[model samples]
Target: MDCVDLTTVLAGITLRNPVVTCSGTYGFGEEYADYCPLEALGGITLKGITPLPRLGNSVPRLAETPAGLLNSVGLENPGLEDFLVSYLPKVRKMPTAVIANISGFSLEDYVQMARALQVDSGLAALEVNISCPNVKHGGMHFGTDPHSAEEVIAAVKAVTNLPTIAKLSPNVTDIVEMARAAQRGGADALSLINTLLGMRIDIEQQRPLLANTFGGLSGPAIRPVAVRMVWQVAEAVDLPIIGMGGITTWQDAVEFLLAGATAISIGTGNFVNPQAPLEIIQGIKGYCEKHGLTSVRNLVGLAHKG
Candidate 1:
């Protein structure tokens, strides 16, 4: 009888739709402007930034696999001041929601960046990259330990005035444990399953393909794992979930929604099909219309019904 309601809100920010572009893939919401209209999608999660500028990993930073891609891009960015001075002003006026992704090797690093960014800076929310290794802790990953994850999230939450989204790492013993830790630390929402730890080697050179040796894996190859994590975490965690990691099509996006993601973010999929989000948005509407569902919310976590 009426158009399907596509709007969805996460972390207090209302999105035009439940589709978002993952950070580190979308370049500050401009690179894809010529291909995908910025206004058509839900939000854009800008590339991850750090307190200081980084050159990122050296050459051979990306490798292609059958159904995926591996990257060791490090956290290369223009640092905090440069982003504030140059980027923030532009993104604030973007048609859709704009989210800032922050990465750090220490709790202080996260806190420092958190202090600088907020709704006033034109960001709808802050996605904390706790998946990064904690250099202050003998190289152990912060997302792997419940205590470390909680402490880091709390520190960032305390300093940042914007909504804090804890981006969980999939390379953990228990995804639920990390989700709970972030909640305990007062996270506003959760982005489930960042890239999984992976690597590739060149036979001729007899060395690792990525200069950093290990890299984060993304794309279709990791879809099943990502969906599983979203399903598991949604069943246990109470916060809104942004499901990602290998969503290349409308079907994949719907799977995440049914698994309980309040929203679905497209990452490596953009590289494969720059227009994927537009296609997905249309497809999702069609799906809702066919099912006689009045809103996208009606479809979320439907699979959990027994």
Candidate 2:
């Protein structure tokens, strides 16, 4: 197994493996430092941060579904200034790459956040989260519209030298269009299929389950949709993709890689098992060994070979 290389390159950045912790689920990478060795994973995408601090949504922000979880966290974070002053330094010391996820209400907000991150020498890349369904004015609004998504990506790219990844939404009408838009806007990579918009009804109370009335749906139920979107986007664009949505096992991650994702991220799976990423990392290595493969990169888009 030592001969099998799990290392892969994304947007010119080298990753020890392809398993990255999805933003918003892994907190700021510090919460899980004790639970799991942060250095063992490929990368950690810090929780979505904004130019200004956000308190997030009200109570009843989370609901559990049959095979999935619904969350309306509303991009809660300590804001860019505090993160740079306090968290970035600690994140820099970690062995894995630190990818910052940024969300915004306006084009300027994205630009401002990108500019601030430019001076952070510890940062690896910027994941522009335009697909947050929890927010009202921005978030999914920009992601659903191709033109708006392009505008935000272009604006951020103009302000930062760091590699930029445009995270796309599954709630859109045509995921491929959005992917192409992001590529044209100068995104170095793309992360597909942010949680699908969903809602739950409290039958007894006859009201919405979440206080926000709606939230993003994630878990095994959305895996098929996520893979489909990743494959579609991969075929449509030339940029590297970080595919995520309901990936709970190495098999699931491998399915995404075959579907055309250059790498994969663990989201809801993290909540179910803190060691999920590490386990998946080992699983991928084991799988490569079993298949007589020398590198995990060889598995990307293998399903398209036929």
Best candidate according to lDDT: 2
For each of the candidates, the C-alpha root-mean-square deviation to the true structure, in angstroms, is 1.7, 1.0
Error of 1 at 40 (Å): 0.8
Model 1 misplaced stretches (Cα beyond 4 Å): 133-140
Quantify all predictions' global Cα lDDT against the true fold. 0.90, 0.92
Q: What tens-digit string does per-residue lDDT give for candidate 2 at 167-250?
A: 999998899999998988999999987999999999999999999999999999899999999998878799999999999999
Q: What's the TM-score of every candidate structure?
A: 0.97, 0.98
In angstroms, give how far residue 83 of model 1 lies from its true place.
Answer: 0.6
lDDT of 2: 0.92
How does candidate 1 score on lDDT? 0.90
Alpha carbon lDDT of residue 261, candidate 2?
91
Candidate 2 regions with alpha-carbon error over 4 angstroms? none
1-306 per-residue lDDT for model 1 (tens digits): 469999998988999999999998999999999999999989999988988897877878899988999987887789988999999999989999999999887888889999999778889999988874312332137788899889989999898899999999898988999999999999999998788888899999999998888888999999999999999988998999999989989999999999999999999999999999999999999999998999998988999995
